[model samples]
Target: MRKGDTILFETPPAIAEFAAVGGKRESEGPLAARFDLLFEENTLGQETWEQSESQLQRHCLDLALQKANLAAAQLDLILAGDLENQCTASAYTLREVDVPFAGLYGACSTMAEALGLAACLAAAGFVGHAAAMTSSHFCAAERQFRTPLVYGGKRAPTAQWTATAAGCCILAGKGQGPFVKSVTFGRVRDYEIKDINNMGAAMAPAAAETILRHCADTKRTPGDFDAVFTGDLGIVGTRLLKEILEKEGLKLDNHQDCGLLLYDIDTQDVQAGGSGAGCSASVLCAHVLPALRAGKLKKVLFLSTGALMSQITFLQGESIPGVAHLVELASEKEGQA
Candidate 1:
């Protein structure tokens, strides 16, 4: 039933195909080969980081469409976003691709946000096929959010490296497998966290909010799903979320963070691990979806977390606002029919 902010899709939409493309650094990570394709260079043949960001989105979309035996023109709608100002990276990427486009921005949570909206539209018979995608570039994000790359200032230990990657997933009114059963859109949350360096802390409450809210709204427990995946909360935020959930008497038995899973904490020296819209996007498409397809996972809750802070807001000493969007994915063999 379409009630409140969450939509329970009676005819759950299935992912037809998905593609995750990453930069060189991401390719060297634990889920290395899980990525559909990897660019050996961060430029991706683009002359600028912003252009590279656009290219990343295009690459993922093209690959996803190719895998699904479809073309850019075949998609009924494209819901996508990125961290760039105005979401220009995603907008410019699909500007000429010729599909009905909708630009979204949930920061890192865009992956779930885009997917949930697409699933709802598709499942409701509003579209025959839809594509959800997002991308981010470390250099581009750093330039926009922080300091100059050439400045080379010391990065705080609490900081997370923005992932340079992109992921795309296609959904149809009906498809083969890995269906989206529900969506719980998050409300903006503020913990009054002022440290721009500590995004995990800023976003953890929102993640906790969406998770518990999804449980309360759906009448399910943490044990109901085989896995619960949160967006880029890294180590610190993951711990904070656990504590918050524990205080509420709901222990997350099977939970992991895309940020923590993206990089090697010990060897990579990525500080708190990876964050950005692409972190969850790439990981979900490349790793989690594959596991679901393989029957290794049955039911899963995917939460993409985002920080809603702007440079101006941060400069003005305002607190960071956080958000998280949730979607339930189930293996095709096990999805409600």
Candidate 2:
């Protein structure tokens, strides 16, 4: 059922299995041990960076299916997305898989968006099993969005590193716990911040708006959730998000950002932090969902933010618009509510 800007599922879909794969850099990060697979090099035996990204998605989905003890043919649907142009990485990755596929492009918010749609379909009895996955590769994103590695472009301090990682989660109509309870889709919020290097500032407003809407629609406060995670809002965006929420009389004491948690900023060269579709997707699969399943957390809010801008739009001097999608997850005990 619909409640204001949020959709509350009568029968929440359970996350049956999930997997995370990362590149060399991510393997050295704080949550490296949590990943299901870590490639020594960014290229997973692929000739090109784009092909490597496709390999990331394929491997992540395969691992998830293996963990679930199911084959691709058992899935009713597959929703996938990536940072590559036209979402080609996801398209190429799933070409061999026979499952029906839907390509999404919410930029960094693709994971949350995909998971929300998958949950809704399962709860409505449209599908017995669905998979939600997304990926991003640093080399591929750099080549597409910025200058090539050969250019030696200087990055701004506010710039975030695009993580070379992928994550996938299989959702079923019936399973043991970590249920998707509700979803809140965000509105496009353009703050006229045209600096392409600072994605956090461009996306912060949208994250704040969606978070507030979710809380309002659900008649809950930030304290109600065991933890609230934002997609790729690095240090800069995370601070901005908190400031925006604070003005509305909401204090996020339990807040954590996927970008910040994925790497050790003090040691790593990632300016602000991590940013990409894979940033949150990988962290969610590697860390958050596991905690929920282990009974270490109860109710949690996962909001993935995205900056909707194209190279053409950037060159045209058009302002970037940001969007965030929220998915509410609860433990099996709380799922009973």
Candidate 3:
């Protein structure tokens, strides 16, 4: 397998800076203080949800550049993605910016996928500096994935609330802060669960497979990390992942889910918890990165999970497929020190 699915970067690219922006609903969450910008209106001063999502991307880009103290022209490339079909939000975002951009789609796993690619590019010396970012909007996702807002249909307990937010990070050739040590790209796993409403169940197998592969390839264990975070598994998915890992004779000491951490599940009425691409992206940018930078977290794993399903496939009675990607981040070489 040649080091397997995990890619160890020789140069070890580091995140120079990052930024996270959220919408009104997300701003009301427990991690509200971490956000760089929160919009009072979901429109983001725009007329539609799609436009608003694009603005969210733009907001993250501007804030990221400001935090890094770098200009737009200085970025070698920008990698971005979103939940909209055809990557509409990311496409519009790139159109307005002059930097070279690559659009990505991994459902909710976009953030980890994009960051892994960006880190690899920088680590390989192909790019000196690159921007990796992603975003999601509740209104836009629901309208496309399920029913229209006007329908006002009841949601199941397993349903997750898509976060309306954006997260962007700048990867440099060399710097401090949370640095990428390795990235494990996941393979598609379909467990044959066809309920479109149950996203956590759809994505759990993929998450488990990737984590197991990464640990086996790197010779690391759950206790080796300060925290292991999954993208948007919510309450249900978290429990499922734990069970799957245990059956494989692996156990996690400090495991967390971006979906569960984003909001108060009991009080927020967020069914299982938060989902969507931006949920993990925004949470990591606002909370996780800060912890890494502050030395509170010595080593962490950001595993983004995605459900590879579409309206057409769902209508055709096809089961949902899933994928996950993992990025290992360390706090500025603390273990070696």
Candidate 2 lDDT, 1-337, residue by residue in tens: 8989899987788999999999998999999999999999998998999999999999999999999999999999999999999999999999999999999999999999999999999888899889999999999999898889899988999999999999999998879868998999999999998999999999999999999898888889989889999998998999999999999999999999999999999999999999999999999999999999999998899999999999889999999999999999998734432
| TM-score of every prediction relative to native | 0.98, 0.98, 0.98
The sequence of per-residue lDDT tens digits that candidate 1 reaches over residues 1-337 is 8556678987889899999999988988998888989989999898999999999998899999999999788899999999999999998998869889999999999999999999989988998999999999999999999997999899899999999999999999888878999999999999999999899999999999988888887878878989899999998899999999999999997998999898898889789989999999999999899999888998899999999999999999999999999999988634452
The deviation in Å at residue 96 for candidate 1 is 2.3
Which candidate model has the greater TM-score, 1 or 2?
2
Clashing pairs in 3: none
lDDT of 3 by residue, 1-337 (tens): 1268889866568899999999988878999988999988899889999999999999999999999999999999999999999999999988978999899999999999999999889988888889999999999999999999999999999999999999999998799868888899999999998998999999999999999999998888878899999999997889999999999999976999999988889789789999999999999999999999998998889999999999899999999999999999988744421
TM-score of decoy 2: 0.98
lDDT of each: 0.92, 0.94, 0.92
Where is the poorest 10-residue window by lDDT in model 2? 328-337
Model 2 alpha-carbon drift over 4 Å, by segment: 333-337
Query: Deviation in angstroms for 152 in model 3?
Result: 0.3
